[model samples]
Target: MKICVFGNSHTACLIEAWRAVRLGGEMDFFVQAGTGPAGMQLADGRIEPESARHRAFLERLGLPVRLDLTHYDALAVVGCGISKFRLTDVLNCCHVLGWPCPNPSDLPVITEPCLRAALSDALAGTTGASLVRRLRAARADVPVFAIPQPAPSERLLKMRCTGGGFRRLIRQGLALHAAEVFRQVARAVCSAEGAVFLPQPDATMTHGILTTGSFSTAATRLVDLKTPHPDQDILHANGAYGAVVLEALQAALRQGGKPCIPR
Candidate 1:
């Protein structure tokens, strides 16, 4: 089967996780766009990769701008942090995060609407909503899925987007809300397309929560000291998150009679 994934850094981690699963079936093709873990810099100087300016910037960076969906049977759009902006006449940081303007000292506020719009726009543009409409008109069949971001944990929120102090604060405040928004988007997309949404597994073991005994001292040192691709390594799956996603995908494919690796 062929699958195309679109989205930001977290999508890269998703790809790596799928690679680890070694699904045993051939992947006809896999195309990914935008920053995946390493982050991206857009020509318009925006910090986020999902923006239109960032997409154009990637084209200038020599990445393929458009995907040919004709060859793929399924497309998955990985969830990423979506910035929220108010409908006010003037767009500003407060508007983006929904924080009160008079008391600029308070923590940033986040709402569901902003996150929904961001996810919708990203999927619609990348997955070809109009193209899908045309395909349906022509009697062609395809599947599209939106993989929602995992439920936001305070631990994860503290570590996200830490480069800038203000940005980090804003992200931390909005993290859970953003995840919820993605969840809504996943539901909406799946309902519209008869597709599936795979939630992360429920395993409690994560890389950061590993015990020293789980890895040899030497291996742990290598990881701690930043040996090759330490950031890409997964020591364990937290709360069976990986397993749950794999199971959901397998079930979805089974309904289609598609071959997949036995879990």
Candidate 2:
């Protein structure tokens, strides 16, 4: 299979993981990445990469100068600005109920709410979803999959020393509920547009919303060789996490159905 992937910063991890594992003996992959929707557009029934930065990145990767979605067997779009607000909102609301309460048993049960805005904003015609729709329009027979960025890193919950108290405030059940809500929203929106939404793999998650330590260790940027500063922690993942994502995509391809979310 030959798949072309377009994404933001998270694209590096996926590309690296796919290369590292050498997935499927006959599989081939190309990646085009940028910080956001800088130079992408849906025009005349096709998605085009117009940003110099995107082009340069592709050049560095030794990919062709022009990449047309119709030329590939499938398209995978990941990390198209699905913000962390949904998870943050849940944490903020939990705080009001004395989250770090003196008694864990007495803490209020938190019910997760659907943050439709996250998906609505991400799937707007001019945003990430546009690429998916344009591809489908260009080649109705091709498969398009929208992979959510990896979950937040477990390091997020360990910021207790910095006065964040995230460790004390984040409860497993509440975190898991928030994840389910986001997954449901992504599935509904992407599926309606004839795109499959692939949730993060089960092995990578910890505390429901955060990726495990091994997968979250390194954040690969376009130029940098080192992991990002602590401030940019969960925004990126190591190649190991990327391997998991590739595995999930293979499973989806083989099963030929909506991808499953690991609880």
Candidate 3:
């Protein structure tokens, strides 16, 4: 089977997890941008077309210029940001980490409609709408699956309280919040079309570990802190989480549906 995952770093994590569980070369994988360490690169070394850091990191990963998805059997769309959906208001106010409010005061002033408009504009001419269209066109034949983003790590949440003490705090928070929003959007999109929405595993244990300060050991054991994208601590999937997602996908497939991929 071949799978094409379009999104950001979270998508990459899912691909990695899928690879770990795949045996005997039965499956092929492809990934696109969403958020985090993995993604496509531009001429200047950016992962996407926008950011310098992302470009540099893309160069570091050595990703290919284009991925041919014609032979894939599944397409797993990972979570994006709240802003990505234009729901900045909900995020600015209720987000546990003070999202959409890089400066806490910005929260009180940003209006919901304005946020919506901003998101709409940001998504304009992007691959998102095209992806939706492609899914609609292919739904009758291909099995399209949506994977919800996992909950944020406790350390990440705590880091938020530091008032951006960490250099990339705001960026990380935005990415996490976006992933949450993307999960909701993906589910809605799938449900409307009778496609499968794989339920994300309950992240209480991961959260609990963060709240109780067990992250040090967990990070050392489960994460590669020495990697270039060290900021991805929150995005990386451990062996356990990866296993859960894989099992869920397998279950979904067992119901007699083919994997979601392009023709």
Candidate 4:
């Protein structure tokens, strides 16, 4: 089956893994790194580069100038400002009733309904969500998948910013509860747009949040494959992790499984 994927720098790992596995004709990719959501939309059922940089990057990666979803059996939107980790940022400020708040007594509590509504609202505006909606609109027959950027590496436990959520949630017990809710919300949102939300592989994470060092070490930038992600870089995964993701995606396609969080 042919698959077309669009993502940002985190996609570099997938590219490297694809090269390693030699999926010569089965895969195609477009990498556009950054937060701006200016240029990615369908025109006459085709998606082309939004900028010269995007075009150059696609050229260097050897992808077609125009992406027509009809040609591929599956399409995926990965990373590029999409992730379950976004929940942590929310947790840091305010948390839902069952969430593990750092200062539970001090921080105000929100109902699960409130959290879900907020997530739905946020998902509606995301570029990833927009792309998925358009991809499905352009080709209803093709299956679409939305994979969030992986959680931070457990090695990041060294830093307060990255590890604080994991530490706090794990300490409070029922850590997986919030994660499961996030998975459900993501799935519901993506499903609404005719895409399936694929959670990160269970083996890649620790304590339901931080990724293991094995999957995260030696990550490279999509812009420059030579430059390694800095030691403190916790978001990106390596080629091995990419391989696992590819495998998981394939299996998910085959099984057509529900988006349930792995315990």
Most accurate candidate by TM-score: 4
- lDDT digits (tens) for residues 42-105 of candidate 2: 5654554576775675666654545565566667777765433444544444432322344444
- In TM-score terms, candidate 3 sits at 0.52
Per-residue lDDT tens digits for candidate 3, residues 92-189, read 44333434435545434444344444444443223443443344354445676656444445466555543232223245445444544444554554
Name model 4 segments beyond 4 Å from true.
23-25, 36-38, 98-105, 256-263
lDDT of 3 at 124: 29
**Which candidate, 2 or 4, would have the higher lDDT against the true structure?**
4
By TM-score, rank the candidates, best first.
Answer: 4, 2, 3, 1
- Candidate 3 residue runs with Cα over 4 Å from true position: 23-25, 33-70, 82-91, 94-130, 138-140, 160-186, 193-195, 203-235, 258-263
**Once model 3 is optimally superposed onto the true structure by TM-score, how far is the C-alpha of residue 259 displaced, in angstroms?**
8.8
lDDT of each: 0.38, 0.62, 0.44, 0.75
Ranking by lDDT: 4, 2, 3, 1
Better of 3 and 4 by TM-score: 4
Stretches > 4 Å off in candidate 2: 25-38, 41-48, 83-126, 160-169, 224-232, 257-263
Model 2 earns a TM-score of 0.75
lDDT of 3 at 142: 60
Model 4 backbone overlap count: 0
- Model 1 lDDT per residue over 132-188, tens place: 332233223555554543333323323444213223434346433433454566455
Query: Among these predicted structures, which one has the highest lDDT?
Result: 4
